[model samples]
Target: MKPESDGGSEIKNYLVDKREKSSSRWTRVNKTFTIYDIRLKISGLLEGSDYQFRVTAVNTAGNSQPSEASQYAYCREPTYTPAPPSIPRVIDSTKHSISLQWTRPMYDGGADVVGYVVEVLEEGTEQWYRATQKTLKTNLFVAAGLQSNKKYSFQAAGVNSNGTGEFSEPSVEIEPVEKLSIPDLDLPDDLKKTVCLRAGNTLRLFVNVTGRPAPVLTWRKPGIDLQSRGFIDTTDSYTQLIVEKVHRYDSGKYTIEAENPSDTPGPPGSVRVKDYTKESVVITWDVPSIDGGAPVNNYIIEKREASMKSYKTVTTECRKTLFRISGLEESVHYFFRVLPENIYGIGEPCEIPESVLICEVPSLPQDLHIVDIGKTSAILNWERPLHDGGSRLTGYAH
Candidate 1:
């Protein structure tokens, strides 16, 4: 006898071989004895679950494996599920683009995933557009050529023979940023006058300007009419002047003119030169608060220091910011002042605020003597002097 399950009911079939009419392969004693075990083969199944089965015993000792089992409850081919793909991460941003990278998916459904698909949507846009083509690559990608200051949304999915997998949650929209404009000119405080240098001494100054297309710079020396031959000028797009080897003759007001065709004119800047000394000098001036014209040159360094009575001339032309003095003599006091100079002429001289004195001797003790002597140590004493020949003498040491 053979039995098969149909839905919830069991259907029995009486079977008898031509030569086995009395054998257990046929109906026997109201109980069915199966000569062979019943097996089921399932065709299709979803990934990720177990299939059920059941078995039935037979009266035949040799065929005890049970041919009367519920074949409908048995599993044939098993199915395995794949893990979901990892969420993509945004790692970098630019004015017009964003970069995205992702981890591998934990599950690939039942089949191996072939590629990944990316989609993006602009803010307020109802439709989503494909951002990238299907790719097996697993590196980061830049969503380039995006609109500046615009927001966008993005998502990713896995692709296989079964078609695209479910999409991940959309990432937060990020807007592309616009490029920054150039900075405006803001002169420093305490800049009021032109720089002053002794004969054969050099001075330097600084000026700052910011703008798009870069600002143009022009230099000037006020108060003193600068002969083209007497003045030297060099320039970069940002700075205008390079005063080389300045001298006392170079002392005057210096004007720094900054201009940018892309922007409104910035304030005209100036530095004053004044207070000449044998070795060093000092200068005080005011910086322009507003950008009126263009960027100024760095500094027109002027120096005037000479071992002999006749001084050599050096000029740092096309300067904008603070000015400095160099080539000063040691053991000599100096007074320096800055002035604004430009094509218009030299501006008023800024007074010198401090005095710089270069001394020949290093700081050391002077006029030392032993007051009393011991076996190992000696008591020494000396009187500190107010000044040494109008020179500051720290002390002399042994």
Candidate 2:
């Protein structure tokens, strides 16, 4: 017990006593204790007896007045032990290390938890090895010096003044592996086949590849690099190229290449019809963009009526990049496409939409009239022709 004083007197020691509430005489409970010591323990007290305690302070000057008696207090010892910690779990892993985490024990043995311990066991082994040194104050620990491609299991326990608690259930088995490797191109044979897309339409090309270290992909066209043009995009294992409002000039041999020390290029090119007329149409195409690492020998042209699926070769050995297809039906729609050929074989053909109608001559104008007549010259006017024959009208002749 402490005593209050008006003077600034320092305390030197304390004297304590206890007695039954009904008894008038007080009995000393302990020896005089130093000022630094404020606690006292008494034993051999009758279990059913009512008792009270009082204290006095001694200073350098003198002893202070006795303090008021304290209230009745009970004394008991706790015996419950703490439960084991939750199972340790792998939070993260690398080729050489793994991070483990766990929750605290349910009970701390009626005392504050001092620390935690972690243990690891290799697959197929009965021995468990300590993975932590000097106990861990945090719930997280990193286990290092692990071999790659090897499996491991782990567990954790809580420590208190009572000693280390029971170990938690072992974690699920896990294996560590290296995740880096060289690039492997995964271009399908169907993708290597040439494809024809309509003009003024959107063109989308997708290339898929796989690699351990992740390969760098690039798209290249004849005389142009798509990466420099900022037209290429990557998503996971796929590289894509999208062209909005594609035109004849957009037609070309496009090659997708994957590289990471080693490089692989796709095969083939595409073509399209630039313009059409009733009697003749101009077709333009690109060489095999990838060329299969060989020079394109020439191009082949095929034509068929829009109603037919079979195509007939118009020019099988054409060497020019452009061709004029003539002798077509005036009012009929025709499908025109071009194929690139190398020493190996012919590649996929690029085709245009079947809606391209051939142009034809317009019918004669109606309602011919002479607006004004003169001696030397006369002015004439007439209604325009009903059909322009799929071609834009420039003018009319007398």
Strongest candidate by TM-score: 2
List model 2 lDDT by residue over 1-398, tens digit each: 35556258667677777877678788876564353577766777776577888887777777667778878754444534457889888776655678889999987887778889888999889999999668899899888899743679999888887778888999988765333455666766766788788988887887777864357777878875565543678865888888777778778788777765322222334456666667788887655555433345577888998899899989888876788888888877888888776555676677874556788667789899999998999988899899898777878775
Which has the greatest lDDT? 2
TM-score of 1: 0.28
lDDT of each: 0.51, 0.74
Local error of candidate 1 at residue 252 (angstroms):
33
TM-score of each: 0.28, 0.31
Off by over 4 Å in 2: 1-81, 178-398
TM-score of model 2 (CA atoms)? 0.31
The Cα error of candidate 2 at residue 390, in Å, is 85
